[model samples]
Target: MSIKSALAKPFAKIIYKKVQKWANNPVDTQKKVFEELIAQGASTAFGQDHDFVSINNHSDFVKRVPVRDYEALKPYVERVVAGEPDVLWKGKPLYFAKTSGTTSGAKYIPLTKESMPNHVEAARNAILLYINETGNAKFVDGKMIFLQGSPELKEQNGIQLGRLSGIVAHYVPKYLQKNRMPSWETNCIDDWETKVDAVVEETLPENMTVISGIPSWVQMYFEKIQQKTGKAVGDVFKNFNLFIFGGVNYEPYRAKFENLIGRKVDSIELYPASEGFFAYQDKQNERGMLLLLNSGIFYEFIKADEFFTENPKRLTIKDVEVGVNYVMIISSNAGLWGYNLGDTIQFTSTKPYRVIVSGRIKHFISAFGEHVIGKEVEQAMQEATEGTDIRVSEFTVAPQITPEEGLPYHEWFIEFENEPQDFSALAKKLDNSLQKQNSYYYDLIVGKVLQPLKINSVKKGGFQAYMKSQGKLGGQNKIPRLSNDRKIVEGIPQ
Candidate 1:
């Protein structure tokens, strides 16, 4: 074996040991994480404001720190951004991860020195855990091509600001750096289309063993590689065996990827965001990701159905049940106290704690009280296209609420790479699949309260064009799948 592979084997063993310990006793791991975070930030302004010193357990902590969203935490974040020390965490943050916002223009999330390791470690351990579980460590001997955002971080009040992926790229492990691509110069390109071309030029001929990125961008890279080489991705990189993906659901794009690669390869899913790395797919036999209970974040869950109510029931890991969607609330070493992450997740297992991201709380459609979310829409789309030749490039759903439309109906704007023979049948199947998934939707259709779903076949590249128009074409930018209003649907071209 080469010197790098020889060194990595021992490190992999150590990480696997740690993963085994965490997996064996997740409840204890969670309690320890909660205590450590509270103790670490006990002297910060937020900690004092929330009575963090007096908090001894999960119940006490929850009672002291009320649930809050980004809007509620903006004041404290402003202080941190303005170079205030010990404002949120123990000291000033190393950088701020700037994420796209809805009502607000942008969200600047603090990334402290203490908390940065959690992000890096969680990601590293995810790969290590996979390696341990599958006995596939040879990939480390080759290069890893990570499709990330611009690495050119902007500074504000002495605090660096950039996309989370870009921020993390700066801290990639030294060992991996030797075999990582594309170059930092290529990654610093602000334009995604331009950046992808540069990345392809740099890494297309390298001995790439692993590829990691959002599905859409990676698909573009795969297409470019095929166009340049005139060969399948599998043929180009014979050793490429792993694809690590996050930022969006991979189900819709799985077939397209398989078609591009010409064969199936092992894959891993991660639940990382600007907020934190929450979970990773640890077991091939399991469906959901293993929740990172021991990470520097303490988690709470409020039932998604009750999140908008006057008083919602908040539950910890101890009380979270399988099969129920919950809005994730987190308190972390990064100084976010009871911050609502705005994402909904459903527990698939409780003993070792596994979860599946259901959807975004803000990205749901309930216009006629028949609530539907991203997961439901994605699943329905998958079901609708099953055994058919159709492939959805991108899609969004919106309520056509105006009476001038004759009947209230849900309109689906879909961009297809491979069009199905029967568009009407596809729409009917999607509607029927949704009805089966959501009882409220089923009741509405059965009572004739709502008309059948309408599918608007969007022109190719319409969604991409819409994203570009919004100035959010790549890297963590995704079209919200469901909306109560027509903002997203109206923006797309048929």
Candidate 2:
């Protein structure tokens, strides 16, 4: 075996041991993590405001701290941005992860010394766990390319500010750094098109064995590589064996990716956010990712249906049931107290605690009370396009509430790489698939409350153009699959 593979084997073994232990007693481990966080931050302003000193258990913590979204937590975040010490965590944060927000134009999430390690360690452990479980260490013998945000972090009030992916790039382990592609200089290019061109030049000649990034951006890189080298990705990186991805659902893009790469490679999903690294796909056979219960974050789940209510029923891991969608609330060592990250998830398995991201809470189509979510739309699209001579590059669905010529209906703007033979039949199939997945949608259609869905073919690169306009074209930025309003639909070119 190569020296790199030999070194990775031992590390993977150790991580597997720890992961097995954590899985054995998840609830107790989580409780201990919560207590430690409370004890560590009890002296901070946020801690004192929430009465953390007297909080002795999960129930007490829940009673004391109310769940809040980004808007509600802005005051404390503002203090942190102003360089205030101990406003949330023990001291001023080392950095802030800049992310898009709903109410606010931008959000600056604190990343303290204590919380930063969680992101780094969890990411490392995820890869190690995958290697341990699959017995695949050859990939480590060669370089791995990660398409991420620009690493040129801007200093804001003495704290570094950048995308979470960029911040994490700064902390990649030294050993792995040697095998990581696209030099720091290339990664810092603010313009994605320029950065990708540089990455293609830097990595096309390397002995690359793994590729990791958001699926959309990675797909872009794959296309660029193929265009430049006149070869499929598999041919360019003959030993490539793994593809690590997150930020968006991979199902819809799976077929397109397979065609681009020329062969299927092993893949693992991660649920990482600016807030925390919540879960990772630990087992090859598992359908959902294992929630990181002891990863320095206390978690709570509120039913998605009741999330907008004044007092939604909050449930612990023990109380959550499989198949029910829940909005995840987290109290992390980063000093966020009961902060709702706004992504909805459903537990696929509750024993070892595994979950699939259902959708963003705000990115759903429920105009006529059908309550169609991200997962449902993804599944419908998959079913509708299956076994057809059609390939969709990207798509978004929105309610056309005020149609000039027809009844109110849901309209889908689809950018197809390979158009279907029959557009009318494809639209009918999509509507039928939606009815099968959502009972409420079917009822609405049957009762003549809503018209059949409409399909609008978008010009090639329309979605990309729309994303670029929003300044969200690359890493961690995804087109919302469904929207209640026509913002996304109207923005795309027909």
Candidate 3:
């Protein structure tokens, strides 16, 4: 191995060993790890705001900590960015990652020297575990193409830090430094006209291997390539390898990608949000993903219903039962101590720590008292349209409280692979599939909720057009596959 490889490989091995051992009880191991890290100034106890005196003691260490969301953290993050040793933690933040919020405007997440390691370790473990399983250490035969956000740093107080994209780019291994697509000074916030063409042109001549990014941007590039070259992306790229995507699911866009590229694309589910990296696709099916427990986080799971409450029942990884859906909470070294992200997850197994994301606790519309989740809707759509050209690209279901006929109705907007002969029959079949999957919806349809599922057809690239217009076309911004509001659902094209 070269000197660079020699240095990185041993450290990677040590981290991998710890991850392998912690997969069994990721929550407990993380709790202990975070406690030690807190004592080292890397983190803080969550209950320190109210029960600081008591939480500082040893006996109450493992008890649950009160959960908080990003809005509650605004003041503290502001102070950190302003170089003040704010509320709980002490340190001048080295950088702040900019992420969008539902209502708090935009969030400037502080990333100090003490906090950056968590992000790096999470990203590193993702690759290390992949290497251990596939035994493919040198997967990048040519340059590894990262379809990422603009590399330009937004400077605040003479310190350079803006987005996760800029921070990650700054920290890439020196050996692979030259392989980056967009140069550091390029204005990513500018229109796609300024950057996309050059990025495609530069990489075409090299030994391009793994292509990584959000599914939409990659699809955008694929489309752009087709327009420019007068040839499908498959013909242009002589040796296109693995297609690793994160941020969102590729199921809706997969067929078009494959049809044009003429290659089977292997995907890695990247469940990362502005908060942190959650889980990844299984490199080996049965083993699931070797979740990065030690990468700067202490984890906990709560019953989805327990979220948004002052007192919630939280479970450690050891207490996690198989085949049950739960909400995810974390205490990370990045200073989010005992934060509830509100995303829901399902445990596939416990021994090796395997899971599949079920839905979002906040992503439901029980306006008629029928509790419906994103996963149920997705599964129902998949089942209802089995073996039909009427595949849904994106969809949403929300309750309409005020109806002309005196009942609330569930509304849906569906994108298709091909036009259906009888869209009305397709709509009824979709309603049936939903009713079968969720008894709550079935009851609502019969008595309370509403009747006659309302359906609409969206034009191609309708979702993409909406996202681009919102200036949320890249980074953690994703086209929401499932939602629970008719107003939000109507925003997409028909």
Worst 10 residues of 3 by lDDT: 41-50
Q: How would you encode candidate 3's per-residue C-alpha lDDT over 379-484 as one tens digit per residue?
A: 7676666677664555566666676776567777766656678988877887888788778889878774478577777788777667777776655567655556
lDDT by residue (tens digit), candidate 1, 1-494: 67766666677789878877877887788789888988988899988988888999987876788898999999999999998999889888999999987678899999988788989998888887777777778889899988888877999988999989999999987878888898988888889889888988998778899999989879889989999999999999999999999878888888778888989989999999888899998887798998988778888899999999986988878889999999999988788889999999999998678999999998899998988999999999988887777887888899988757567889998888898888889989999999999999999888888998988889988988888888988888888888889977777767
- Cα deviation of 400, candidate 3, in Å: 3.7
Question: Which RMSD values do the candidates have, in order?
Answer: 1.6, 1.3, 3.6
TM-score of each: 0.96, 0.97, 0.86
By TM-score, how accurate is candidate 2?
A: 0.97
lDDT of 2 by residue, 132-236 (tens): 888789888799888998888899889999999999999988888899888988988888888899999999889999899988889889889988988889998
**Which candidate number would show the highest lDDT if scored against the true structure?**
2
Error of 3 at 36 (Å): 1.4
Say which prediction, candidate 1 or candidate 3, comes out ahead on TM-score. Answer: 1
Q: Can you give the lDDT of residue 227 in candidate 2?
A: 89
Clashing pairs in 1: none
Arranged by TM-score with the best first, the candidates are 2, 1, 3
Better of 2 and 3 by lDDT: 2
